[model samples]
Target: MAVNLDKPQRWKEDVARSVDMYNQWFLNFAPGAFRATRISATVSVEASLLATSYLRDIRPETMKKNPSILSMLRMATCPPIAVDRLIGLAGVNSSLVKAMEKDNRLPVRVTGDLLDKELQKIGEIIERMADPDIFVWLARGDEPRQEEIHRAATIVADRLCGAQANPIIRNEQEKRQLAKIKTWLEARGYNEAETKARVDFQNMEPGTFSFRLNVKVRDNTVNIPVDAVIMPITANKGDLPVLIEAKSAGDFTNTNKRRKEEATKMAQLKQSYGDNVNFVLFLCGYFDSGYLGYEAAEGIDWIWEHRIDDMAELGL
Candidate 1:
């Protein structure tokens, strides 16, 4: 990648565009996160509009993907005093709706008994907002202005990133989804039958490498192909070429018995193919599933692991 000195500015521009698009498409999604906010109860028509504008400027996808912002704030170790103060401000109940509006304060709606219960919860969140870690107001702040629900999502995403410090690997069903990736590749002129196709490249230098993948589809009269091979021809004719088994994350294991079993399988493949089987191994995985392994052969480091992430990202 070429070094770009003004990357920060460029990144901000992309984030801004993402946020704007998110607000326009999903702001009024009923029964969603937006419904659970103060703006829904008070009907601060103007405030909601301003809040939407503010939120459209910041990336809301981050928040939408993360856990609740309130939960993240509590985990951040915010002080007690800060929490209490915010709660007190939020606890205001049965305020004169018109008076509160005239004074530019949050307008409270009249809902009789249920009003007290909701106010209590809102008060607590407000108290937490008092922390000098002002962002704790979460997708809040901007007094008297109805905060856009989209802003809430971004705040939650920020809190999750800043507080969790965990990868929280998503797409747990990656093993199942990998099939789509293969199907997508085939549409792009990637023929699985051609993976086993080899072209003689004599006089190639040591440490040279080539890859092949053969996929089988179900047919009444045909066999299903479920194998891939990556060949790394060694320079020393006397030295045995190393073969690697490329399986998906869950398929690959580090047990001693499994390693020995794989070794035996490779020995059989070598014997069956002879000189043609310079390097033979099972490459069983989707493009993005990270289960590739590595080994050194004759001082040459060979990555036997099949990588799917980069290939999938490229839509190959």
Candidate 2:
């Protein structure tokens, strides 16, 4: 059955409701809650061994004075020196002093006035392997353990440096939006089973279906995964599946690129599915003029999470 597209007023209301729900949830979001979960997993023994070996001889007094180098050492995820490479540079089984380069781990360059340049180089190398942020923990005068260094390194690498650091928050938002969409679909006579959290069509004929929609971003085409979909248990010869893409964002800035990306994805899906599929963009927050432009340009049918009453217009 063909879907309805004439309920503009209802669509607006749905959008407003969805935005309100998102705003309410965002207000209570605690970033620290996510940060607290960072150390749930333990670091590998190999990594700990490497970290311990690197920091063995560094004096606590020197580490405190130049904490930046200590911080780098604590955060280093991988061994800076490959065993083979180290052996080549300092001779096989050489002392730690010969292994660290003179300028390797020191925050400031060591002058010729300093005696025993090799030992200073070793100290600097140890400092380079540790993360600076852990210096506060070290300031307590507790001897650094290999596992502690490894854990701090993991936090720095995965939480501080990684994109999507707090995925739990994003995931919760997606789940909320998906639940809202599923509720709307069920109220409009779509079977609860038909509206699912994740939908995959892997074994379908090669050219006839795609699990992901691709969009051109800069010089590359990026694939956006469809969060959910509604498929009839038994399809009439001309009946098409309804594709749902749900997005939740705090504000326009965070969603601009995503909004455009989704629009591009919708355009591609429409081209591929033609009359055989329907598309709905379920947005769970506020959008600005730029978002509206992309939505209009793509000719996408969208509904706000709050104003979900428009689902009735689908006439399923």
Candidate 3:
């Protein structure tokens, strides 16, 4: 599909309109929107019940078998330093730590007496969780005490539901974007099989060279995965072999560094592939005001900017 050069300006205008609308809503009615509702109403009651039952028996064995229980508790606790210490003290498997690291959810690092103090706090919380009085209050829906229990239960339920639902949501979104891009390309006479989704550069060119962008390690090279790639039909095809990198950022506050890193990657890709390959960066969802300018300055070949719902109109 051809790049829509005018779309980025249109997207900026759309973003401004959305921001104005959200600002108006927030000023008028967004605050205290859910203050009147109970925490239990915000989450599944059945899931909270299940979590309560599981939390009652939170031994090392049970924790290892049901890591989600620990995950929920960790989510409920502020900072979660105590939870991390407790997990380490409980001697849970290395997989939990690895998963935490992968998700960027690892708690603060502490050692010696400080860690012991945190563990003590975590143990007290665990004791409270296991107490029969709390469970009784939770079951009876008692006021005040029940509110505390309900808040904890809702936190667990929210974390568990998010863990289960986020992957499905992201995958569906990726698939939808891919389908739209593929259809747009096919309409313009590109072969269906030529456009592939989830293409890893390692599979395409293994060990020939590494594309390092803002990466700090010498031997820790990773394969960059393109969301969608259009392969060249012939060796002399000048207009083919386009690499598309699509990213949807749900929040812009924490995305500045990531977007800069992406710009570095785009520059690195252009440097590595030179004029033989084309690189397109497709951005959707939230972005900072200066993001497009930064991407352009980084030497990206093309950028198709639109909202998440406007993916079909990206390259039209």
Candidate 4:
């Protein structure tokens, strides 16, 4: 009952359509999403700059009193640097900077005494390395220009948010796909599971679905997260739930590169739950013949976003 997977010859046509659909969606919505996020980020960066007095007072006491500003410290510099790069430049403890960047706060173990020393080193590096042209207001001996502050914040916002814009789009796309699945399943009398943890498939009422369920695999020690779990309407006691992974890719190269991850998950499921385990993919975006062929060879199948109704073939 497989669609494009069973009919290998039709792969080229399906792939073309899938890619076109993804491109059209991106062209229509991606720019607006990016701009909205950047606008929000700009507001945040401007607030951080104003709090720091335009990077003129990055003293340990100031940073300690306002720990949240540490996240934006590098961005406020003349030329922003990433956390790892700042660590390399400042020659500070890698763990400290890594923790700061990851959690957006100073680690609790870093005492006030240590903070002074660390901030001194980091501040000196920024002062020495930051571009003189960008920080000219510091030497001008007058109030920082409002336009300059806005321009600097905008640049920082672009750096901070632009890198994550594609990922934001991908998350939004996944949410949309899941919403569609919810609507269709609900229409068919499928109830949504309320539990946040993994559910016992046998106990789940027939015709129920859950999002982001975790399944124990690989000898029941490792947990594999699936996008959706569905109990077929005709399910009986002890029947395993169907597992669906929602996948999207902007290009063929990344899909081919990450194709093995799905195969690994499939192998783990089969090993733990036996060959009867129902694991599948809900795919959108650019997956080419090469990617599809590999998945098919591994006995993995997919339901395209364009053909969501084919989920019926899986007893959804």
Candidate 5:
């Protein structure tokens, strides 16, 4: 019932087509998306540099008042270091710095005293590692030149861009994919789920679809956040809703690296519920034949974004 999956020759053609489509989309939209993200990132980085006194005052007290500055501190360095590198240089707990960079605060386990001590160590590390030329305006006792500030912020913003998972593009792709799915499902009389809580999969009403639904395992201890779930008009209370993962990739490398995640999720689903639980991938972007082969071997099936009508194969 799956399209192009049973025939290797046909699947290869589909992969080429999908890759071409993704490339075209990227060529058209990715630059604008990156520019928008970079502009916002540059503004934030500029503000951070200003707040840090142009990297002259990374004192413990300053850091204590604003742990979020730690990220800026790392970026302000000559060759901007990663979070882990900063932690290593400071000889502090990795979680402390990682928490600060990620959540802009220390973890709950870090007490006030511990936070002060950690901040002192981190501040000393940044002070030692701060780029002298970048902070040269401090020695002159004058405001940094506009161009100098802009250059510093741009470098930091560029580094931040590389370090991220490219969230902006991914979010846009998800929005578009979800919107398409919504239109397709609605045409078939599927209604959106009213509540945002964990979906009662077993008792899902007929012809219902939900976005970002939480489905718990048999023990109810862990919940899996599904991208979309749908119940067909023919389904009864005992039937499980159809689970779909909306996936996109910018490159082949990441898809291959992350291919195991889908297999793991599928294993968890079948282990918790039953083999009959339907799980599918709604894929776009740079998934290649190797990635497809891996997913297929794991008993997982996918519907290409180029061929979304293939969702009917799952009886949606």
Candidate 6:
């Protein structure tokens, strides 16, 4: 469940609370990056873009007066994972309405065109991740946490899913529009392809890789439908690159647990694929709010969590 820190007063309190949790939990030099993240997480472009100045001492807005290098890690927007979650609701009730109407597809309130301008708006926002200007604002912090980036994505998703902005349509033209816009905007998970999966274990991507590992055993069954993981990064041998499962903002500091759990799977993976397959888990969230209670699994060597609230932090 997402925390309700939509208001300014509540946002400050949330950031302060998160800072305390991290400073105490890690017991290391956390720096003020987390606080900066907290501040960014609460900012809304709708409000921030127009507001000439913010209240003094406000958590995120206060940076305007006493900005520091650490605060640059903050994300100016929400993460992509969260935005996808929000899109889950696109065109919701269409099926039920179609059934009631005894028709296969439901007609749209905004007819004429196959796609709605509002629906395309979401695709546009998702595209902004690759937009040089937008991403620079999001990844402003130093070493911005992946979890924090995911939080920003989630917020963006929620905004898109909101009734005021988001609407669902099943028209082919609309779907095509979404796909084109999503691809252009660099929307998170847009890299994922949906298809009827086959059950096989030949290491083929299109087929579902069944059988359980030590890490995700309980959650997965012996024979489960799996989606092909599109390569998010280009790789060459000896480049020190390995795949990591990414997470969104929501008690992500539990990455400690994620790391430990991934360790179990990593060992099994190594046994099958050789130690050449290094193990790591990516917690995709904003770093500022701290890993939303997520922790890297115990004994995990390297974990690379990435939050794409903007491209600046990635130095892109």
lDDT of 3: 0.47
Superposed Cα RMSD, model 3: 9.0
Runs of candidate 4 exceeding 4 Å displacement: 1-4, 59-71, 105-112, 131-136, 195-202
Worst 10 residues of 1 by lDDT: 295-304
TM-score of each: 0.23, 0.54, 0.53, 0.87, 0.88, 0.26
Writing each residue's lDDT as its tens digit, candidate 2 over 148-248 gives: 66655565545332334436667767766677766655564555432333334422221122223332223345444666555543444455555667767
Q: What stretches of model 6 exceed 4 Å from their correct place?
A: 1-194, 199-228, 231-242, 286-316
Cα lDDT for residue 235, candidate 3: 24
Tens digits of per-residue lDDT, candidate 3, 139-184, equal 4544335565575566555554455453444454455556666665
lDDT agreement with native, every candidate? 0.32, 0.50, 0.47, 0.80, 0.82, 0.32
lDDT of 5 at 278: 87
Candidate 5 lDDT at 65 equals 66
| Candidate 6 C-alpha error for residue 227, in Å | 7.6
Candidate 1 lDDT, tens digit per residue, 1-316?
1111123344334334433433332334312433333233223322332333322221222222221322333322244223344345445443522222234333345454554454345434534443334333334454322243345434443443333221221122222233434453455444332435452233223333223322212222322122332222223554433333333222224332244444444444444444443332322222111111221111111111222333322112
Residue runs of model 5 more than 4 Å from their true location after superposition: 1-4, 61-66, 132-136, 145-148, 165-168, 194-198
Query: How big is the positional error of residue 240 in model 4, measured in Å on the Cα after superposition?
Result: 1.7
lDDT of 5 by residue, 1-316 (tens): 6554566677877888788878888889888877778888889888877777777766666766677777767866777778878778888988888888878876788778787788888877777777767766766878889898898788778777666637878887798789999999999888988765556776778998889888887588888889998998888768888899999998899999999898988998999998997898988888888998899888888888898898887888
All candidates in order of lDDT, best leading: 5, 4, 2, 3, 1, 6
The top-ranked prediction according to lDDT is 5
The 10 consecutive residues of candidate 5 with the worst lDDT sum are 1-10
Better of 3 and 5 by lDDT: 5
- Report residue 2 deviation for candidate 2 (angstroms): 11
Query: Model 3, stretches more than 4 Å misplaced?
Result: 1-53, 76-125, 129-155, 159-175, 186-221, 232-240, 250-255, 305-316
Clashes of each: 16, 22, 0, 0, 0, 56
Model 6, 1-316: lDDT tens digits are 1112122344334445544543353334222333333344345432332231211112322222222211121222234223233245333223322332233232345332332333333334333433233334333534324454445444433343332221121122223323432343244332333344442233323211111212222324422221112222333333332233432223335443444454566565555556555343322222332232223222233221211232212111
Cα error, residue 151 of model 5, in Å, equals 4.1
